[model samples]
Target: MTMVLCIGHPERSPVLPLHPGARYYAAPSPVGTPGGDGTRGRPWDLATALAGGRGGSMVQPGDTIWLLGGVYPGRFDGTLTGTSAAPIVVRQYPGERATIDGNLHVHGAHTVYWGFEITQSNPVPNANDALETYGPDCKFINLVVHDAGKQGMSFWEDEGTSELYGSIFYNNGTHENFDHGVYAASEGGEKWIVDNIVFDNLAYGIHVYVGSRHPFLSNVHVRGNTAFNTGAISRDGFQNANLLIGGDVRTEHMSADSNLLYFPGTTGRNLRLGMPRGDNRDILVRGNYVAGGAVTLLMNGWAQAEVVDNEFIGAGTIVDLTARGGSIVAHAWHGNTYVRDPGARAWRYEGAAYELATWQKITGLGNTGATGTTPMTPRVFVRPNKYEPGRATIIVYNWGHQPTVSADVSSAIHAGTRYELRNVQALLGPPVLSGTYGGGAIEIPMAGVDPPRPVGRTGPTPALARTGPVFDVFILNRTK
Candidate 1:
């Protein structure tokens, strides 16, 4: 009975399209000379406005380079190339704050960096990276990469599509030689990585490798982001992990939603998904919110994954699949929610350990049920319907612990259009309303009853309605 559909009024990001041209300026103690002539009151030093010299003065394609506010040492490589609709921005100079103490490569393609701050402390043992791209449709916004002796931002064997929004990778591997805090690998394009904020890294905090002979990392997405205490300093005990998706190549259309993982004393492994020389099909692990971790999700060998609605708090062994071997196709672990620490054993197949009801009866695999704490589910909230233009205002919330007795709602309008059901309220129980409305569907049958539970209520509570479960449906549309 989990039917959540919140449509209209919330998706907005998409308005990048600019092409104006020339405007350069750089200063790390400017005021002319260092091969000045980058105009904007003659500015230029920051490696001569990114090495645009040798008698040609580069940085073309819809230009714009303004890095003005202090500290800007060594390495800036760039090469320039802008063209996915004329990009090549490189910002930071209005309310200033442009610190870049070293490292930043990018080999040339639609660039657009905005709001910088990469601090490569003493790097250079192995060319310590703190931002190294091979170029493609680049777009980093609000970046803040930190102290690195290795990785903090890398897209290495590049190809095309790339974007990392609202970034902030912290503490990065100093001499222990960084492993990742954002590292996308070879082959082709596609990667969005939204809202970012990876923490103390010394190994994986978002690493997507695809080696075993490249090709097949298709369309990655990773949403909302907020990883914590990543691998600390792994000397390779299987490279920790906060979000690692190794590779024998092939990982079509990936997705990691709602992210927010943690790993306190750090032993890492908040989400690992390796094994894909061929079938890792459409992978998706939704609504994440994992905690602490000894192993939050390690589905090593086989993959066709789709773990939904996550919330595995205080993990010690949430799901370990003993290196997975044979007969497990089309995997799915729905609604997820295991609180842990009473004896800690959620799962560990094949080598034996199962807990969530004997691991959902020998792996037909967790069907939406497991909770020792953190399970309130059932929350839908739609809007529009102020004065009716197509009207809509659903709000079903049943903070459960044993309540919801019946619920089967549906949406999707305009087939013949004529739905009408105003303000039906059911604070608790006997509201008798039964389904079938409108042509495009609008079914509803929300009978209720939930309240007892003080140690004297084992099941039914028909009319003692205790004020939990809130309801309100107000749809209306009449346009034949």
Candidate 2:
């Protein structure tokens, strides 16, 4: 059972690059100072060295324990088992400094890959939890858990489910007395994908529950990471934003992408889904760039979710979904780009009785004129011509909320003109220009223009033709 290859390039397989610093081995290096052999630079200080006494012994799937940097402080129960074919890793030996100061909390049958820092030298009483995996694939990478009072990195997969990357969950115990940073409870599919994590002063950066498809366990990729100045302290406690993918049992692969979420005076519902019950279908809120916090993305009980291509800046009612007892069925929103309180008016598609013709507006083909209806300020480009490769074309200028600057289409553009476009993903009536004549006395010249309200903007009330009436399409760029 020897399969540790993650390193690529020569042709591609490369991904094995988790050596932030130390890698010293000896003492049989398995657990550390096993029978005292302690070699590779003469290492020995795992708690008091000598492998903490090798408690329940097992750790042998390919065995690899490094921990080398500094400060490793108390109350550390032990047992590091492993074997689903070779899976024991306790990292940090590629460079140096791997610390676990106190309260590792173990029960039995192990698999502990605690990388960097697993802090705790002072406060940890409220509930108490610095680390707990009860045993499963058990992996806690690039770790950095702090102040712990409870749930810094708690996972009880029952049998298997544990994988946290780039961790740094801090201050953990104020929100309601500690909620979670990377806490997974375990049920069916048993999953955890906590990626690029970093939650300041606890209350949730990444907390999943019971299992099922385990919400499919998507990236948890809470990107960029930062929950500064925390929820403040609502009379005695605080902590909200940063991320909380709860679960009473609703699995469909939930995902909160490109994160930078923040919560100042917390209350609740930053990115919550209370669980309520089950059927929590495929949730994937994309490219998140949220700011304040009110109800960034929440969907209560009876599940059915899919909020796509997200970019809800500022945050207020970007998404509420509603589900205490009523609405929320077969939910499907498309091409999201809400930006209300972030700086001001920007609601590409606010929710509440929402049904933009079934959502799929991801436009793009070429000749993007009419500027999505004036206002041009929200800039983001890149789609010159690859005929759509993985698809990504954002031209959201005057964006949503029925305000495309007044839809002018710039008098039908003419600066070397040559069009043949069709990249209009919904929100029709403003960006429709046409003209492809070749000969035959095509003397087209209108005086009081008014006759061309049809390009592509289906159902759900797609009939608002009164903004500037100018039309002159045909801006092809295929050169085919």
Candidate that scores best on lDDT:
1
User: What is the lDDT, from 0 to 100, of the residue 228 in candidate 2?
Assistant: 31
RMSD after CA superposition, every candidate: 21.4, 22.9
lDDT per prediction?
A: 0.61, 0.42
Q: Which pairs, if any, clash in model 1?
A: none
TM-score of each: 0.32, 0.29
Off by over 4 Å in 2: 1-33, 37-51, 54-132, 135-154, 157-183, 186-207, 211-244, 249-259, 262-272, 276-296, 301-317, 326-338, 341-351, 354-480
> The CA-based lDDT of model 2 is what?
0.42
- The residue-by-residue lDDT of candidate 2 on 169-264, one tens digit each, is 655553363556566655533444433334344456566655554443332323333333232322233335456664545455565554445443
TM-score result, candidate 2? 0.29
Candidate 1 C-alpha RMSD relative to the actual structure: 21.4
Candidate 2, residue 453: how far the Cα is off, in Å: 46
How does residue 389 of candidate 2 score in lDDT?
Answer: 17
